[model samples]
Target chain A: MTPETVTLILDIAITISLVVGAVFTLVGSFGLLKLDDAMKRLHAPTKASTLGVGALLLASILGAFARDEPSLQEALIMAFLFVTAPISAQFICKVNLHRRSCMTPPEPSSDSTWATLDTADAGDAPAQHLTPEKG
Target chain B: MSFVDYAIYGAFGAVSLAQLLAMVRLILGPHTADRILALDTMTVNAIGLIVMLGISQGTQIYFEAALIVAMLGFVSTVAYCRFVLRGDIIE
Candidate 1:
């Protein structure tokens, strides 16, 4: 193909990627807002938003190549995001689980043991009104 | 305007609006975990916006910004989660 044709193809690819990435991010964020459960919210940002940003990063890489600069940094950024986004999501998920237990009615730890990590006193427990488990 | 130009602007607007929605969730979350989730989503959206901006500007610098944001956002999220999980950052 001619050089002009190649340029056109790259431009088109970049444009598509950009639009798709944006839509994915928006949908993911909307899920975060609308979803009622914490676990459910995890699905949106971890899967869709990550894919969205990944697409944009891919576009940036393509744009760089089209300009003859051919940057590898955007690729590195993509890799970093891929590695960290899940780990971050996992961490936040764990936090949510623990925080929920702390501030609400205690649940059995599956070992039949109630989770009483730091009962700092009556005042410390904000959700004391929540009935404690009777296991 | 060209198709590419339109895409750039549309991506910017969409991601920005998404970021706003995440902010609303952060403020209104009934549970601590919900707030944390909102914060994490915000960081992800911010990274997407930065990368989109980089593409639109045809620059390399914003790529660096996106990488930095990713690294720091992960660390902060992990640290905050750790605090909630263990009630302490160290030991």
Candidate 2:
């Protein structure tokens, strides 16, 4: 096969792979919106998007080789992405959970005010004042 | 439109829409985790975009950049998560 023909085929294949990867990413993003909770939302992007990017990267390597260029740099990029994205997501989630649970103690003055308000409200209520008194 | 190009464009359109939805989550999320997840999703999609760009341009540099982004994004997420869980960065 001629170099020209090989290049054409590689181009077609790479295009197809990249488009599929993009579609997967889009779906994963949609999952982020549709899922009810953080953990559930985590699933689509991490799993599906990772695979999608991998496909795209593979296509890149193929295209690079077709063009007679070295692909080590591209490979390195993929390696970096694969390693970092998930770990970052995990850290943020853990921080969020911790923040939600940390409770602040009420100030003493505010506590006293609350107590006074409660007692005043309770004292003003008549205890069955409408009932007829027993003779 | 050529069949292949049409398919590629369609995928791009769909993914863009999905990225928008994820952005909404990032903006409206009540908790940090949800926002972080949404951001991660966006980064992953960005990698996909870079791949597409690399393919279209017939170059390898974009792909290399994408891999780097993926690595850095992951490391940052994990580091922040650890910070949240432990409430301390050292020891």
C-alpha RMSD values across all candidates: 4.9, 14.2
**DockQ scores for all predicted structures:** 0.58, 0.34
Candidate 2 chain A has its poorest 10 consecutive residues by lDDT at: A126-135
The reply for model 1, stretches above 4 Å from the true place, is: A101-135
List TM-score per model, in order: 0.84, 0.69
Estimate the lDDT of model 1: 0.79
Q: How well is each residue in A1-135 modelled by candidate 1, as lDDT tens digits?
A: 999999999999999899888999999899988887667777887888888988888888889988889977877777887888878877776655555523354556575543443455546444445433221
Per-residue lDDT over A1-135 for candidate 2, one digit per residue giving the tens place of the 0 to 100 score = 998788678768876776777767777777778877555677788777777777767766776777687565666666766666566655554444445421223447645542312335544433213332111
Per-model TM-score of chain A alone? 0.74, 0.62
- Per residue, candidate 1 scores C-alpha lDDT tens digits across B1-91 of 7788898998999999999999998998767767777887888889888877777777888877788888888888887777666666765
Evaluated with DockQ, which candidate comes out highest? 1
Every candidate's lDDT? 0.79, 0.64
Residue B5 displacement (Å), model 2: 5.0
**Candidate 1 falls in which docking quality class?**
medium
